[model samples]
Each structure stands twice: as structure tokens, then as C-alpha cells.
Target: MSPDLKTSIVASLESAAAKAGLNLVSVTQGTGFNGQPTAVFELGLPRQESLGRSLNLELSDTFDFDKPDLLPEMTAHLAGEAKRLRNPRPDSYVTLGGLPLAFRKFQWPFHRSTSGADTYIVHGEIRLEDGREHGLHAKISASVTLTFAEIVPAMEQPYAETFIYNAVRKTVDMGQLEFLKSGNRQPVPVTTRYYSRWQKKFLFTETDDNERLRYLLSKVYWLSGVLGGSKPVWIADPRDSQYLNTGEADLLRMAGHEAGEGLMVLDGEFAAATPALMARAAEYQAMLEAALDFTKPKFNESMRSGQANM
Candidate 1:
């Protein structure tokens, strides 16, 4: 990408973020592994309010605007994305001690030379100063990508009537389903496309720790409904997935502890792509669990020694 174009795109994005009351933490221009022009936009909640918990929204886009006319179009494309980032849908599972479980989307933006209209995600995050006060003092994060085109048409069908029967018959054959329900827990709810509610508004819920599971179950119910349609699928592959840390990971590290539990669901395409990948991830999960067990005793000891000195 030319320096002039890069400068223009950044300026356009910064302007949009400012107008939306968002802090444009950083923006970088580069090329993707596929050699396509790429840019990453990192945004955060305004700094005026200081809360222990935080939210960061990152967007990655790949474009090709080699022609003169397309050069100017790049700015418009980015501006549209910036607008999306300023708003996102509500899909909360569980909120933690001082932080809420953050939801993010792995939207890979690409260019289409064809004539039809294409739907894209307008991705961003909302911060509630103490939204996490209700759940365990840990981080629980998940990502899902829903397409507008895929979901609107399927809203009237009996989701459970069809999905439950199919899932029961196919559960054993579907490796991803088995993996998602690993601990005898219900399958992870992920949707391919959702009717974009967060695209315009954000609802705030302030509660204590007692309602943790209520929030989780509600989120799960929502996920099951949204993810039941045909075009929208749950993301299950770990490789293409991204995780968000709203200070929980850092807090755990600072206190000589680590996340005891977490989950990452892959989109259907990747999840169903191969059996070998799932097996490998399962193996890695086992190793990680063992490591966490070894570290827990040390963490406990450190806490005990600190308390003794106090």
C-alpha cells in the first residue's frame, strides 16, 4: 500500500472513532500472508472513567485497490467498518468479579469484484464499569460470526424441533459437537448470523455474583436460538480464533495464578474441515490442564505466605 493511501485510511478511521466517542488506541498498515494489503484497527473505551475491567476491539481487513478509482473507495470502506466498530450486538454469557465476559468476532474482510451487495460486521465493544461483579473472578470469552443474509430467512422455523433431532442422531458422528460438550456440559451455542441488535444499542445490567449462572444460562439460550439457523455457524477452530483479555489474564499472572476454565468455539467451516485438528487441540488441552494443576499449589502457597506476613 502506498504511504498516501495508508495515511488517508488512518485519518478517516481516527475521525470516525472520535465522532463515536471511542479511543483509537492504535492503527497499523501492513500486508497479509497472502500478500494482500491489510490494516489493523485497535479501539478501546474512553479513558475518562477508570474501571478495573476493560474492553478492546480489534478489526483486521484485507483489501486490493490497485486502480486509481478504487484508491479513493478504500477510505469509504474503512469508514463503513469504523461505523460498525462503534456498535455491536449484545451476547453476554457470564460476567466476572470486576469484568464481564467479552464477546468478539473474527471477521476477515475481503474484497469482492462482483456486483452484488455483501454483508460485513460492524464490530466494537461496550464497557460497564462493574458488569463483572456478578460472576466468578475470572474471564470467560467467546466469538461468533453471523451473516445477515443467512439468518433473516430462517427465523420462523422450529429451531429445536429440527436441531434437537438432528443433533441427537448426529452427535456421535460430529467430532466438534462431542468436543464442545466434553465435560457432559451442553453443546456450545454459536450462530452463523444474527439479527444485528447491538448494531445500534447497548443494554446495561448491574448485578451481584449470585446471578452468574443465570446470566450464563441466558446467554447459552440466546446462542442456541441464534446459532440454530442454516447460514450462520458456530466457530470451533482454535487456530482462526482470537481471545480477548479484559485484565483477567494479567491480573491472574500478577497474583501468580492462571485461568482455571475457558472455552473457544470454532466456526463451522473450520470445525468440520478435519478430524485431526480437533484431536490435536484436545491433546493440547490435556497438557494445559496438567500444567495448571502443578501451578495451583504454588499459587496457594504464595497467597498463604503473603497472608502470614500481613
Candidate 2:
């Protein structure tokens, strides 16, 4: 583990403990077994002995406990994350996913050349049990921060924001319509109150537009369920991603993106969340309505005439 990762975990846990109305005693990140970085953050109870008793540990009944540190609750969240991190590494590989953005997948022009920067190869050596040396080679990684300071052309924020908002609105409207059509459920009810809340959340607040857009996009997923329809997208199937570097391709294709081109979307929990699914459903409804409306002239007259004849 990295020192930064450990530090981050400690900080997050401490904050969580504080919010849960628990007294935070100490958060420490230090070197652990095998000299790997580790963080051990625990909430300290005034009545330490009393808190320890509530836990379901093998020794929970063996001690007096004080605070109700939600170990079981925290452990549940960790289990999902750890499962993702330790999924059967069929190819014995792991990945730190990239920031989601639409991008063209570039092939290395040469054996080691890519659209990325040129970096020197790094080397390290490891000792085997027999005292033999095993050499480890590390290539320069793709660094995003290096380009952060580079000056770029100006963009029309107003026009771009308008276009995206219109696109997003179309999706939201669709989901809302679907909900109304269902005759029993709320279309997540985007009235002045709801729209105002969402409008401000995305426009006024210093929030990520992509997140808001995605949240709205997820409305379609929810709308489908409300209307009794579902698009079952797999969270992360091992069978689909069995081959090395294949998961990325599978993910992109499933989401209707190019096989090699990347896409950004929520993970398993986020996708399954009520709000996100609803947003997806809304987006889908918007798309369906838009297509239907576009070809309305061809069917509207017939529909009206058929109704009149009946």
C-alpha cells in the first residue's frame, strides 16, 4: 500500500467516526509487515471497556465495551471494496482505473511509443529464496498532472453548458413522462421544488457537471423499473473480463461506447442505487420519446384517424 492511500483511509475513517457522533481518538498511518504502508484507525470510547462488549468479535463477549464503533457496518462496505480489489486475478493483474472521459484509444506507433509522453525505463532487483536476484522493470506511467499546467485554447462555457443542459433536460423529461404514463408512480417528480433543487445542485453549486449529468442519466434506469421495464447491465462480470485488458473493452461495449474507446459510469453500488437507476431510466425515456416524436408525422395522422373511425 502507498503512504498516501493509508493517510487517506485514516482521514476518511476519522471523519466518518466524527460524523457518526463518535469521539475520534487517534488516526495513524505507518509501515506495516513487509515494510508496506498501512493505516490502523480506531475510534476511542471514553468507556473503552464498555464499548468493546457490543462487538460480535470472537472475543466480543469476553470484554466490557464502551462505544458502538460500527465495525460490522464498516466491514460490510470494506468487503465489497476488497472483493473488487482481490477479484480472481485470472491473469494475475490489477488496475487503477483511469479518470472517465471520452477519448480515442491510440495504438503505440512503435513498440513503446504512444500518444503518451516519452519516459525512461526504470529498473529494480529482488532477491529470491535461493539468494538469486530477480530483476524488475517498470516503464514510465502516463502522467496527467504533467499536462495540467499547459495553457490551452479558450472555450465557450455558456454555449457548451446550454447544449449539455438541453441534452440532460431531454433525458429528465423522458423519465418523468414514463413515470406519468405508468399511472401509479412518481417520475421522480421534478417540480419547481425538485427542479430547483437539481438545478441549483448542478448550476449554482460548485459541483461536477459530469456527476450531475450522470445522476440525471441514471434516472432512466429507475424509470424503467417504475414503469416495469429493465435493462439488465452487468456490474462487473468475471466471465466477460476473463482475458487480460479485456475488461475495459467489455465495459465500453456494454455501455454502447466504442470497444476500445473508454466511457465513464458509476460502479456496482452506485449503479444499483435508487437515485442513479432512476436517473438512467429518465435518460432512456427521454431518448425513446425523442425518437418517437421525431417520426410522429408519419404515425400521428393514422393514430388520430384510427381513433376517430373506432
> Against the true structure, what is each candidate's TM-score?
0.30, 0.18
Give the Cα lDDT of each candidate.
0.30, 0.28
Candidate 2: list runs displaced more than 4 Å. Answer: 1-11, 14-80, 86-136, 139-142, 146-310
51-170 in candidate 2: lDDT tens per residue?
Answer: 331110111111111225434434332332223222211111111110001101111111121345432111111111111133211111121122221211111111112112222233
**Model 2: C-alpha RMSD to truth?**
22.7
- What's each prediction's clash count? 21, 28
Shift in Å, residue 95, candidate 2: 9.4
Instruction: Give the Å error, residue 279, model 1.
Output: 38
Whole-structure CA lDDT of model 1: 0.30
Give the 10-residue window scoring lowest on summed lDDT in candidate 1.
237-246
lDDT of 1 by residue, 133-222 (tens): 432211111122234224322211111112212222122122222211112322322233212365521112223333332322222222
